[model samples]
Target: MTGQTPSHSERVDWLRLARTRQVGPVTFNKLIQRFGNAADALDALPDLARKGGRSNALRIVSREQAEQEIEATHDAGARLQIASEPDYPGLLATLDPPPPVITIRGPLVPDDHACCAIVGSRNASAIGLRFARDMAASLGRAEIVIVSGLARGIDGAAHAGALETGTIAVLAGGIDHIYPPEHADLYGDIGESGLLVTESAIGTSPTARDFPRRNRLISGLALGTVVIEAALRSGSLITARFAAEQGREVMAAPGSPLDPRAKGSNRLIRDGAALVEDANDVLDILHQAKRPATAEPPAEPYDPADAETGDGTDHDRLQSLLSPSPVPIDELVRQSGLPPGLVHAILLELELAGRANVLPGGNVQQAWPEDQD
Candidate 1:
């Protein structure tokens, strides 16, 4: 299993890096590229954190702590798969801010196994729930892995229908922790027959903020994300957006225009997402798309040493370029006359330092304190 195994030390360092304060997925990738491995990255954290203007010391996970997490995960019958591993989901790796590590339970049949993401509102209508369940069952029978967040209503129905065939639950919390407390049994069933995956460390509780991050993985791990029912401003819409961004298919089941739950999906169709009536609709599309023989390798890694450093004077100039209003990242790069990677790295550092906030469209805004009239 050495081919499938990430060295213990490597795993420990990855866990340490992931748990570090002010280090998000983007920062994590940068650090990994800068320092060839997580061990070196951990060693360099204090200096980098200081350079990023972090006043508090960086938190690094000890070997013992990581070992305990591994033990807990194994005891829960789950395995840890780092992003670089062969078994890591190919679809997920294509995301810009992919999870560095994910804890998975049960069997993952590699990329060849057909996978579909089913997501919808937690309080779905009865018809929506039935449609999702039936679609999931049909997909399961066809040997497709049904993927969903184990929430109530539609998500619950989908998992229930796919439980016997194959299903994967992508939780916002740790693999050992079950959210929506009532789905505890469903969680157990999936763990035994399907798979449960999470990016959070063992014992982490699901928070409202974590769910959006989790939604990305739900879309990332599948060939397409299917929305059965959702409100205009629901998490399912967020998943569909991520799906679109990742170049994965976004399929939405149509519902009556009068239903508020249908508004999110209807708008998706209007915005160019494919409309789906059932599992066959999803399969038909997948059949038409060319399947690559292997997962595409990750893009060339970012190099921090190549980053252009702005002195105090340049820093002031860059700061002056910002406003309370967010601007596009490309615009910032053009306006600052800096390399795109350099600007991104600097912006990330400022963000860690609590001096900047990232906005949509790759824009950056000066944090309130930095806003000068």
Candidate 2:
């Protein structure tokens, strides 16, 4: 590693790579792995997109835009931290599609131990809210960093209870923009005492789709995710799914079956989520689980130029194998009778050209805009 941190140009490249259209978390990681740093990835983007079959020019964020975002975040008293930064949350960095760049407010404390995520319905019942608060407070006292989405009811209660010790609120919007409007004060408090983080650029507002993505970060940043009260189809369940996918523990607090909100937690319990009754239960589970360690390997140097292999025919074959329906990349390679790297390169080109969408589970599918269809 260089004695100096990555240069300003490199950080700008990282931001641009993150903001690039069709570049989701998985694709972003692959690009970084293939090209040593984001700068090289940015340089290689145009050709990559062309190989992906883009008829029109690809859209890449400009340096000016990234600079403006940096200024805005600094003006808001927050700073942007990339995944490889020292302050980046370790558990979150382990995620396959971890946020490449996150804006954070307040001091980024390094937890000596693993953190646990506590989340639930925004409209939690009185009892559920109290239970979440008490559990969070106990966890805080036990020196566990509490992590949650800064939503209403249970999430809010959890953060508030853990504030005295420490907590982290992962937001759906830009760090400067507070969502749900009503939680503006809570957001400020968190910025003061705890950590507030978001992947969105400055001034960006939360959309209907962003919250689920945010929930994944909440769960991804911890050793376990705890659902206090949630509906069966609520976003909390999505967090649980992400936790399970990332091989993190999923825990739920049971409630009376009579309440509609209880169904989510109860169902999770039935689905084999650890049954969490109190903070002790959480502590016990974490104690039995592996301790927090830096799981990332030392940064390896790479050259994007070296990654290029002449495989025009292979690219065409991979293109012919894709459909609107998402299919795992592994499946594509298996069916295409091509090397995995060649298949990946072809898909990367398609993605850059806006002709493909990479889905979870290493899936790649055709991305046909509504107008085109």
Candidate 3:
């Protein structure tokens, strides 16, 4: 909620807290809102996790490790951009729970230049790839910045089309690591002429789990998302979903019913996504798309003096209510008859202990160690 420039020590603390195990973006934000700063939150994690039922010591990234990560990021020619900073991307800031720390490898594109995400299957058909590239090029010429994950097929084509004008490749790995290694040249070119972004830390490689998190960022950075060709379970659909959840436009290029890759996009159109035939179609959507206003600073997490740590009976009551299914926090508040603040505090503890998954959009699900992949 504050815009004061963080000190070096503050930066390290932020990174440390952000890198702590089980502390995802939503949890991190909650901790910050409650504690007002990362240093205090880092100090509080042990007790929090213990209350949440962790049998082992909660793994918190050490100051030394965090420092090494900063060093590694610098060595890779990238810099950390914290969410509280004035320079953080405006569109990205509007996300309900934006990444606390993201590593950027290029100059910040101005907020005035609208961005659109183009995503689709990694195994795009030839015709689909051509459409994606041409659409991106035309959008670029019209002053829209293209955003995509630098994968094979449609993603690569989109980036290549917009590379000269402006493009952003959102990586699922560290700024230092490249996935689909064949795109080394494309990665380098984008870093030089456009921008590269990621939530991953230095030296961290992309895993299957990372892409969905990365997809959210792709949609978060843009005014809208356009799906070129995607299957029912495509990652591109994930990006479009995120765009819709963030209140941004979701557009899809219609494809043949016979092509499996088109199913997702076609389904999107059927479900009310804007139909995109060409760049002009996308442009028309953008013309009507409302850019989010500059975000107001978030509310304080809670007042420490007024907060109450619930007793054992209250904890047991909440535990009995939470099954493996995801439930809205408000439902927990109502069902348990606990104060909203106490419920969140308990949930934070459960999340830290790895006993629960605190997903985006305020959903919580049971997550025992055995349940994790």
TM-score of each model, paired residue for residue:
0.88, 0.88, 0.93
What global local distance difference test value does model 1 have?
0.77
Candidate with top TM-score is: 3
For every model in order, what is the number of clashing pairs? Answer: 0, 2, 1
Candidates ranked by lDDT? 3, 2, 1
Runs in model 3 with CA error above 4 Å?
A: 108-112, 294-309, 316-325, 334-337, 368-373
List the lowest-lDDT window of 10 residues for candidate 3.
Answer: 298-307
lDDT of 2 by residue, 330-361 (tens): 89978987666666667767677776777655
Evaluated at residue 117, the lDDT of candidate 1 is 90
Winner of 1 and 3 under TM-score: 3
The top-ranked prediction according to lDDT is 3
Q: What is the C-alpha lDDT of each candidate?
A: 0.77, 0.80, 0.86
TM-score of decoy 1: 0.88
What count of clashes does model 2 give?
A: 2
* Native-to-model Cα distance after best TM-score fit, residue 40 in candidate 2, in Å: 2.2
Residues 184-262 of candidate 3: C-alpha lDDT, one tens digit per residue: 9999999988899999998888876689889999999999999988999989998998999899999999999998999
